[model samples]
Target: MPRDGSATRERILETAERLVIDNGFAATSVDRVIAESHSSKGSFFHHFASKNDLARALVERYAAADVAHLHAALEHARAATDDPAKRVVAFLSYFENDADAIMSAQSSCLYVSILTERDLVLDGTSGQIEEAVVAWRDGFAELLRAALPGRTPAGVDIDVDALSDHVFVTFEGAFLLCRSTGDSGHMHRQLTVLRHLMEALLGAVAATPPRRRRAGTPSRH
Candidate 1:
Protein backbone atom coordinates (compact mmCIF):
# COMPACT_ATOMS: atom_id res chain seq x y z
CA MET A 1 0.00 0.00 0.00
CA PRO A 2 1.20 3.49 -0.77
CA ARG A 3 1.87 5.78 2.16
CA ASP A 4 -0.65 8.61 2.56
CA GLY A 5 2.40 10.85 2.80
CA SER A 6 3.02 10.28 -0.92
CA ALA A 7 0.15 12.59 -1.78
CA THR A 8 1.68 15.40 0.23
CA ARG A 9 5.04 14.86 -1.42
CA GLU A 10 3.46 15.12 -4.88
CA ARG A 11 1.70 18.29 -3.86
CA ILE A 12 5.01 19.78 -2.78
CA LEU A 13 6.66 18.91 -6.09
CA GLU A 14 3.76 20.28 -8.07
CA THR A 15 3.83 23.50 -6.12
CA ALA A 16 7.56 23.79 -6.58
CA GLU A 17 7.22 23.33 -10.33
CA ARG A 18 4.60 26.04 -10.52
CA LEU A 19 6.49 28.46 -8.32
CA VAL A 20 9.72 27.95 -10.19
CA ILE A 21 8.01 28.41 -13.51
CA ASP A 22 6.23 31.55 -12.39
CA ASN A 23 8.85 33.11 -10.13
CA GLY A 24 12.06 31.51 -11.38
CA PHE A 25 14.26 29.09 -9.42
CA ALA A 26 16.32 31.80 -7.72
CA ALA A 27 13.39 33.93 -6.63
CA THR A 28 11.28 31.02 -5.41
CA SER A 29 11.64 30.21 -1.70
CA VAL A 30 10.81 27.30 0.58
CA ASP A 31 8.24 29.42 2.33
CA ARG A 32 6.53 30.21 -0.98
CA VAL A 33 6.47 26.52 -1.97
CA ILE A 34 5.10 25.50 1.41
CA ALA A 35 2.42 28.16 1.35
CA GLU A 36 1.55 27.31 -2.20
CA SER A 37 1.37 23.59 -1.44
CA HIS A 38 -0.43 24.18 1.86
CA SER A 39 2.07 21.80 3.42
CA SER A 40 4.24 22.03 6.51
CA LYS A 41 8.01 22.58 6.47
CA GLY A 42 8.49 19.03 7.68
CA SER A 43 6.42 17.71 4.81
CA PHE A 44 8.48 19.62 2.27
CA PHE A 45 11.77 18.48 3.75
CA HIS A 46 10.51 14.91 4.03
CA HIS A 47 9.87 14.95 0.28
CA PHE A 48 13.03 16.82 -0.74
CA ALA A 49 16.35 17.12 1.05
CA SER A 50 16.40 20.84 0.35
CA LYS A 51 15.10 23.53 -1.97
CA ASN A 52 18.04 22.88 -4.31
CA ASP A 53 16.89 19.26 -4.70
CA LEU A 54 13.45 20.46 -5.71
CA ALA A 55 15.01 22.85 -8.23
CA ARG A 56 17.07 20.04 -9.71
CA ALA A 57 14.01 17.88 -10.06
CA LEU A 58 12.10 20.69 -11.71
CA VAL A 59 14.91 21.31 -14.25
CA GLU A 60 15.17 17.60 -15.04
CA ARG A 61 11.46 17.40 -15.67
CA TYR A 62 11.59 20.42 -17.98
CA ALA A 63 14.61 19.08 -19.81
CA ALA A 64 12.89 15.76 -20.49
CA ALA A 65 9.86 17.49 -21.95
CA ASP A 66 12.03 19.81 -24.07
CA VAL A 67 14.08 16.93 -25.48
CA ALA A 68 10.98 14.93 -26.36
CA HIS A 69 9.45 17.86 -28.22
CA LEU A 70 12.74 18.57 -30.04
CA HIS A 71 12.98 14.97 -31.23
CA ALA A 72 9.40 15.07 -32.47
CA ALA A 73 10.08 18.32 -34.31
CA LEU A 74 13.18 16.87 -35.94
CA GLU A 75 11.22 13.80 -37.06
CA HIS A 76 8.56 15.98 -38.57
CA ALA A 77 11.16 18.05 -40.42
CA ARG A 78 12.87 14.92 -41.76
CA ALA A 79 9.55 13.52 -42.97
CA ALA A 80 8.60 16.80 -44.57
CA THR A 81 11.59 17.14 -46.89
CA ASP A 82 14.30 14.99 -48.42
CA ASP A 83 16.77 17.84 -48.96
CA PRO A 84 19.01 18.31 -45.95
CA ALA A 85 19.00 22.09 -46.17
CA LYS A 86 15.23 22.19 -46.49
CA ARG A 87 14.89 19.82 -43.57
CA VAL A 88 17.08 22.05 -41.40
CA VAL A 89 15.02 25.10 -42.23
CA ALA A 90 11.84 23.20 -41.53
CA PHE A 91 13.20 22.06 -38.19
CA LEU A 92 14.16 25.62 -37.26
CA SER A 93 10.72 26.83 -38.26
CA TYR A 94 9.16 24.23 -36.02
CA PHE A 95 11.42 25.26 -33.17
CA GLU A 96 10.65 28.92 -33.74
CA ASN A 97 6.97 28.17 -33.38
CA ASP A 98 7.58 26.27 -30.18
CA ALA A 99 9.64 29.15 -28.79
CA ASP A 100 6.94 31.61 -29.69
CA ALA A 101 4.36 29.62 -27.81
CA ILE A 102 6.59 29.25 -24.74
CA MET A 103 7.39 32.96 -24.69
CA SER A 104 3.70 33.70 -24.89
CA ALA A 105 2.67 31.26 -22.19
CA GLN A 106 5.48 31.99 -19.75
CA SER A 107 7.13 35.33 -19.29
CA SER A 108 10.33 33.35 -18.75
CA CYS A 109 12.45 31.17 -21.03
CA LEU A 110 13.63 28.28 -18.87
CA TYR A 111 16.70 27.33 -20.84
CA VAL A 112 17.80 30.93 -21.21
CA SER A 113 17.33 31.51 -17.51
CA ILE A 114 19.47 28.51 -16.61
CA LEU A 115 22.14 29.50 -19.09
CA THR A 116 22.30 33.03 -17.70
CA GLU A 117 23.01 31.56 -14.28
CA ARG A 118 25.68 29.16 -15.50
CA ASP A 119 28.20 30.12 -12.81
CA LEU A 120 25.81 29.31 -9.98
CA VAL A 121 24.03 26.45 -11.75
CA LEU A 122 27.33 24.75 -12.55
CA ASP A 123 28.49 24.59 -8.94
CA GLY A 124 25.98 22.00 -7.68
CA THR A 125 23.86 19.00 -8.68
CA SER A 126 22.57 21.29 -11.44
CA GLY A 127 25.74 20.31 -13.35
CA GLN A 128 23.76 17.38 -14.71
CA ILE A 129 21.15 19.82 -15.87
CA GLU A 130 23.84 21.74 -17.77
CA GLU A 131 25.04 18.50 -19.36
CA ALA A 132 21.51 17.79 -20.48
CA VAL A 133 21.33 21.26 -22.01
CA VAL A 134 24.58 20.70 -23.93
CA ALA A 135 23.31 17.35 -25.15
CA TRP A 136 20.26 19.09 -26.50
CA ARG A 137 22.48 21.53 -28.42
CA ASP A 138 24.59 18.69 -29.78
CA GLY A 139 21.42 16.93 -30.85
CA PHE A 140 20.59 19.95 -32.98
CA ALA A 141 24.04 19.86 -34.58
CA GLU A 142 23.66 16.15 -35.34
CA LEU A 143 20.29 16.77 -36.96
CA LEU A 144 21.81 19.50 -39.14
CA ARG A 145 24.59 17.18 -40.31
CA ALA A 146 22.15 14.37 -41.08
CA ALA A 147 20.02 16.76 -43.09
CA LEU A 148 23.05 17.96 -45.07
CA PRO A 149 24.95 14.79 -45.89
CA GLY A 150 26.48 16.33 -49.04
CA ARG A 151 28.25 19.14 -47.23
CA THR A 152 31.69 18.61 -48.68
CA PRO A 153 32.89 21.43 -50.91
CA ALA A 154 34.67 20.58 -54.15
CA GLY A 155 36.84 23.50 -55.39
CA VAL A 156 37.15 25.08 -51.94
CA ASP A 157 37.64 23.02 -48.80
CA ILE A 158 35.00 23.43 -46.10
CA ASP A 159 34.46 21.62 -42.83
CA VAL A 160 30.92 20.30 -42.56
CA ASP A 161 31.26 19.70 -38.83
CA ALA A 162 32.28 23.30 -38.19
CA LEU A 163 29.44 24.60 -40.32
CA SER A 164 26.93 22.49 -38.44
CA ASP A 165 28.20 23.82 -35.12
CA HIS A 166 27.88 27.38 -36.37
CA VAL A 167 24.28 26.87 -37.42
CA PHE A 168 23.27 25.34 -34.10
CA VAL A 169 25.00 28.02 -32.04
CA THR A 170 23.57 30.83 -34.12
CA PHE A 171 20.05 29.53 -33.80
CA GLU A 172 20.31 29.14 -30.04
CA GLY A 173 21.77 32.62 -29.66
CA ALA A 174 18.98 34.10 -31.73
CA PHE A 175 16.41 32.69 -29.32
CA LEU A 176 18.25 34.18 -26.37
CA LEU A 177 18.49 37.58 -28.04
CA CYS A 178 14.81 37.54 -28.89
CA ARG A 179 13.83 36.68 -25.36
CA SER A 180 16.12 39.26 -23.81
CA THR A 181 14.81 42.01 -26.05
CA GLY A 182 11.15 41.01 -25.63
CA ASP A 183 10.95 41.21 -29.41
CA SER A 184 9.59 38.23 -31.32
CA GLY A 185 10.42 40.20 -34.46
CA HIS A 186 14.12 39.60 -33.76
CA MET A 187 13.62 35.84 -33.89
CA HIS A 188 11.80 36.07 -37.20
CA ARG A 189 14.52 38.26 -38.68
CA GLN A 190 17.28 35.99 -37.48
CA LEU A 191 15.52 32.88 -38.79
CA THR A 192 15.03 34.58 -42.14
CA VAL A 193 18.75 35.21 -42.33
CA LEU A 194 19.43 31.61 -41.37
CA ARG A 195 17.06 30.37 -44.07
CA HIS A 196 18.98 32.38 -46.63
CA LEU A 197 22.29 31.00 -45.39
CA MET A 198 20.94 27.46 -45.65
CA GLU A 199 19.81 28.06 -49.21
CA ALA A 200 23.22 29.49 -50.16
CA LEU A 201 25.10 26.57 -48.64
CA LEU A 202 22.83 24.08 -50.41
CA GLY A 203 23.23 25.90 -53.69
CA ALA A 204 26.98 26.01 -53.35
CA VAL A 205 27.11 22.29 -52.61
CA ALA A 206 24.78 21.50 -55.50
CA ALA A 207 26.93 23.51 -57.89
CA THR A 208 29.99 21.42 -57.07
CA PRO A 209 30.56 18.22 -59.02
CA PRO A 210 31.07 14.96 -57.14
CA ARG A 211 34.71 14.29 -56.26
CA ARG A 212 36.39 12.24 -59.02
CA ARG A 213 37.46 8.75 -58.13
CA ARG A 214 41.22 8.28 -57.65
CA ALA A 215 43.00 6.29 -60.38
CA GLY A 216 42.83 2.95 -58.46
CA THR A 217 40.37 3.68 -55.62
CA PRO A 218 37.75 0.97 -55.26
CA SER A 219 34.13 2.14 -55.20
CA ARG A 220 32.15 1.15 -52.08
CA HIS A 221 29.19 -0.12 -54.07
Candidate 2:
Protein backbone atom coordinates (compact mmCIF):
# COMPACT_ATOMS: atom_id res chain seq x y z
CA MET A 1 0.00 0.00 0.00
CA PRO A 2 1.17 3.48 -0.79
CA ARG A 3 1.78 5.86 2.09
CA ASP A 4 -0.89 8.56 2.24
CA GLY A 5 1.38 11.60 1.81
CA SER A 6 -1.40 14.15 2.04
CA ALA A 7 -2.78 12.67 5.25
CA THR A 8 0.66 12.71 6.81
CA ARG A 9 1.13 16.35 5.91
CA GLU A 10 -2.33 17.24 7.17
CA ARG A 11 -1.69 15.53 10.49
CA ILE A 12 1.50 17.53 10.91
CA LEU A 13 -0.30 20.78 10.09
CA GLU A 14 -3.29 20.07 12.32
CA THR A 15 -1.13 19.04 15.26
CA ALA A 16 1.14 22.05 14.81
CA GLU A 17 -1.73 24.48 14.39
CA ARG A 18 -3.35 23.37 17.64
CA LEU A 19 -0.03 23.59 19.48
CA VAL A 20 1.04 26.93 18.04
CA ILE A 21 -2.34 28.44 18.83
CA ASP A 22 -2.44 27.10 22.38
CA ASN A 23 1.18 28.03 23.00
CA GLY A 24 2.93 30.94 21.31
CA PHE A 25 4.51 30.08 17.99
CA ALA A 26 8.05 30.81 19.13
CA ALA A 27 7.58 28.60 22.16
CA THR A 28 6.13 25.63 20.31
CA SER A 29 9.06 23.62 19.07
CA VAL A 30 9.17 21.38 16.00
CA ASP A 31 9.97 18.37 18.17
CA ARG A 32 6.76 19.00 20.12
CA VAL A 33 4.70 18.81 16.94
CA ILE A 34 6.65 15.82 15.66
CA ALA A 35 6.12 13.98 18.94
CA GLU A 36 2.44 14.83 19.18
CA SER A 37 1.73 14.13 15.54
CA HIS A 38 3.52 10.73 15.78
CA SER A 39 5.37 11.68 12.64
CA SER A 40 9.08 11.35 12.01
CA LYS A 41 11.52 14.15 11.39
CA GLY A 42 11.55 13.22 7.70
CA SER A 43 7.78 13.55 7.39
CA PHE A 44 7.75 16.94 9.14
CA PHE A 45 10.62 18.23 7.05
CA HIS A 46 8.99 16.97 3.86
CA HIS A 47 5.97 19.19 4.52
CA PHE A 48 7.66 22.21 6.10
CA ALA A 49 11.25 23.37 5.74
CA SER A 50 11.30 24.91 9.21
CA LYS A 51 9.13 26.01 12.12
CA ASN A 52 8.70 29.41 10.55
CA ASP A 53 7.41 27.91 7.34
CA LEU A 54 4.87 25.85 9.22
CA ALA A 55 3.70 28.95 11.13
CA ARG A 56 3.41 30.91 7.91
CA ALA A 57 1.26 28.22 6.36
CA LEU A 58 -0.94 28.23 9.43
CA VAL A 59 -1.43 31.99 9.20
CA GLU A 60 -2.29 31.79 5.53
CA ARG A 61 -4.86 29.12 6.23
CA TYR A 62 -6.29 31.15 9.09
CA ALA A 63 -6.57 34.27 6.93
CA ALA A 64 -8.29 32.44 4.10
CA ALA A 65 -10.81 30.90 6.46
CA ASP A 66 -11.54 34.26 8.05
CA VAL A 67 -12.21 35.91 4.72
CA ALA A 68 -14.45 33.07 3.60
CA HIS A 69 -16.45 33.18 6.83
CA LEU A 70 -16.88 36.95 6.63
CA HIS A 71 -18.05 36.76 3.04
CA ALA A 72 -20.61 34.10 3.88
CA ALA A 73 -22.02 36.06 6.81
CA LEU A 74 -22.20 39.28 4.83
CA GLU A 75 -23.98 37.47 2.00
CA HIS A 76 -26.57 36.27 4.45
CA ALA A 77 -27.04 39.83 5.69
CA ARG A 78 -27.34 41.14 2.15
CA ALA A 79 -30.14 38.71 1.41
CA ALA A 80 -32.05 39.58 4.58
CA THR A 81 -32.25 43.33 3.98
CA ASP A 82 -32.75 45.68 1.03
CA ASP A 83 -31.62 48.82 2.85
CA PRO A 84 -27.85 49.24 2.76
CA ALA A 85 -27.66 50.61 6.30
CA LYS A 86 -29.76 47.76 7.58
CA ARG A 87 -27.49 45.32 5.85
CA VAL A 88 -24.45 46.82 7.58
CA VAL A 89 -26.20 46.38 10.91
CA ALA A 90 -27.09 42.85 10.02
CA PHE A 91 -23.44 42.22 9.15
CA LEU A 92 -22.42 43.20 12.65
CA SER A 93 -24.93 40.80 14.17
CA TYR A 94 -23.75 38.03 11.93
CA PHE A 95 -20.12 38.75 12.71
CA GLU A 96 -20.79 38.58 16.43
CA ASN A 97 -22.73 35.36 16.05
CA ASP A 98 -19.88 33.85 14.08
CA ALA A 99 -17.47 34.84 16.81
CA ASP A 100 -19.64 33.10 19.38
CA ALA A 101 -19.76 30.01 17.22
CA ILE A 102 -16.00 30.06 16.86
CA MET A 103 -15.62 30.35 20.62
CA SER A 104 -17.93 27.43 21.21
CA ALA A 105 -15.90 25.33 18.80
CA GLN A 106 -12.69 26.15 20.65
CA SER A 107 -11.10 27.57 17.54
CA SER A 108 -9.12 30.79 17.17
CA CYS A 109 -7.61 32.72 14.30
CA LEU A 110 -3.81 32.92 14.44
CA TYR A 111 -3.79 36.28 12.70
CA VAL A 112 -6.18 38.00 15.13
CA SER A 113 -4.52 36.45 18.15
CA ILE A 114 -1.02 37.03 16.82
CA LEU A 115 -0.90 40.70 17.80
CA THR A 116 -0.19 39.87 21.41
CA GLU A 117 2.27 37.01 20.95
CA ARG A 118 5.15 39.26 20.07
CA ASP A 119 7.82 36.64 20.48
CA LEU A 120 6.36 34.31 17.89
CA VAL A 121 4.97 36.70 15.31
CA LEU A 122 7.56 36.47 12.58
CA ASP A 123 7.81 39.24 9.99
CA GLY A 124 7.09 36.93 7.04
CA THR A 125 3.95 35.61 8.72
CA SER A 126 2.98 39.04 10.03
CA GLY A 127 2.77 40.26 6.45
CA GLN A 128 0.06 37.71 5.75
CA ILE A 129 -1.72 38.63 8.97
CA GLU A 130 -1.61 42.32 8.17
CA GLU A 131 -2.93 41.71 4.70
CA ALA A 132 -5.75 39.67 6.16
CA VAL A 133 -6.68 42.48 8.55
CA VAL A 134 -6.69 45.02 5.75
CA ALA A 135 -8.88 42.69 3.69
CA TRP A 136 -11.35 42.47 6.57
CA ARG A 137 -11.52 46.24 6.84
CA ASP A 138 -11.99 46.58 3.09
CA GLY A 139 -14.67 43.93 3.06
CA PHE A 140 -16.43 45.75 5.89
CA ALA A 141 -16.08 49.08 4.14
CA GLU A 142 -17.77 47.68 1.08
CA LEU A 143 -20.83 46.88 3.16
CA LEU A 144 -20.95 50.48 4.40
CA ARG A 145 -20.48 51.80 0.89
CA ALA A 146 -23.28 49.64 -0.41
CA ALA A 147 -25.62 51.42 2.01
CA LEU A 148 -25.64 54.59 -0.02
CA PRO A 149 -26.86 54.89 -3.59
CA GLY A 150 -25.48 58.37 -4.15
CA ARG A 151 -25.17 61.10 -1.49
CA THR A 152 -24.75 60.48 2.23
CA PRO A 153 -27.89 60.52 4.34
CA ALA A 154 -28.79 64.10 5.27
CA GLY A 155 -26.29 65.41 7.85
CA VAL A 156 -24.80 61.93 8.08
CA ASP A 157 -21.17 62.43 7.18
CA ILE A 158 -19.81 58.91 7.20
CA ASP A 159 -16.28 58.52 5.93
CA VAL A 160 -16.80 55.02 4.55
CA ASP A 161 -13.18 53.94 5.02
CA ALA A 162 -13.02 55.28 8.53
CA LEU A 163 -16.24 53.55 9.49
CA SER A 164 -14.87 50.31 8.13
CA ASP A 165 -11.78 50.64 10.25
CA HIS A 166 -13.95 51.59 13.21
CA VAL A 167 -16.02 48.43 12.94
CA PHE A 168 -13.14 45.97 12.49
CA VAL A 169 -10.89 47.63 15.04
CA THR A 170 -13.70 47.85 17.58
CA PHE A 171 -14.56 44.19 17.14
CA GLU A 172 -10.90 43.18 17.48
CA GLY A 173 -10.66 45.25 20.66
CA ALA A 174 -13.90 43.82 21.96
CA PHE A 175 -12.68 40.30 21.31
CA LEU A 176 -9.47 40.88 23.26
CA LEU A 177 -11.40 42.50 26.10
CA CYS A 178 -13.85 39.64 26.14
CA ARG A 179 -10.98 37.18 26.50
CA SER A 180 -9.34 39.23 29.22
CA THR A 181 -12.62 39.76 31.09
CA GLY A 182 -13.55 36.06 30.76
CA ASP A 183 -16.95 37.00 29.40
CA SER A 184 -18.35 35.02 26.52
CA GLY A 185 -21.23 37.43 26.03
CA HIS A 186 -18.97 40.47 25.71
CA MET A 187 -18.79 40.05 21.96
CA HIS A 188 -22.55 40.37 21.67
CA ARG A 189 -22.56 43.42 23.90
CA GLN A 190 -19.97 45.13 21.76
CA LEU A 191 -21.95 44.33 18.65
CA THR A 192 -25.08 45.81 20.16
CA VAL A 193 -23.23 48.99 20.99
CA LEU A 194 -21.90 49.11 17.42
CA ARG A 195 -25.35 48.49 15.98
CA HIS A 196 -26.76 51.37 17.99
CA LEU A 197 -24.00 53.69 16.87
CA MET A 198 -24.45 52.72 13.23
CA GLU A 199 -28.20 53.14 13.47
CA ALA A 200 -27.75 56.62 14.83
CA LEU A 201 -25.33 57.46 12.05
CA LEU A 202 -27.63 56.20 9.31
CA GLY A 203 -30.88 57.26 11.03
CA ALA A 204 -31.99 53.66 10.76
CA VAL A 205 -34.03 51.88 13.38
CA ALA A 206 -31.93 49.75 15.69
CA ALA A 207 -32.35 46.04 15.29
CA THR A 208 -33.33 44.08 18.36
CA PRO A 209 -30.54 42.07 19.93
CA PRO A 210 -31.02 38.37 20.44
CA ARG A 211 -32.72 37.31 23.64
CA ARG A 212 -31.01 34.98 26.08
CA ARG A 213 -32.72 31.70 26.68
CA ARG A 214 -32.98 30.20 30.15
CA ALA A 215 -30.41 27.61 31.21
CA GLY A 216 -30.64 24.20 29.50
CA THR A 217 -32.52 25.80 26.63
CA PRO A 218 -30.99 25.10 23.23
CA SER A 219 -29.49 27.98 21.27
CA ARG A 220 -31.08 28.62 17.88
CA HIS A 221 -27.97 30.28 16.27
lDDT of each: 0.61, 0.69
Q: Model 2, poorest ten-residue lDDT window?
A: 212-221
Report the C-alpha lDDT of model 2 over 126-145, residue by residue, as the tens digit: 87777767877888888777
> Model 1 — which ten-residue stretch has the worst lDDT?
212-221
TM-score of each: 0.67, 0.79
Count of residue pairs whose backbone atoms collide, per candidate: 1, 0
For 1-221, candidate 1 gives per-residue lDDT tens digits of 46779888778876776666556677888998999899999888887887767766666666666666656656766786777666776765655444444444444445544545555466564666556556556766776666555664667655556665554466566656765786856654665576568767655222122232233221100
Which pairs of residues collide in candidate 1?
84-147
- Model 1 compared with the native: what TM-score? 0.67
Candidate No. with top lDDT: 2
lDDT score, candidate 2: 0.69
Q: List all candidate RMSDs to the true structure.
A: 11.2, 5.1
Off-target runs (Cα >4 Å) in candidate 2 are 1-4, 106-108, 112-123, 148-156, 206-221
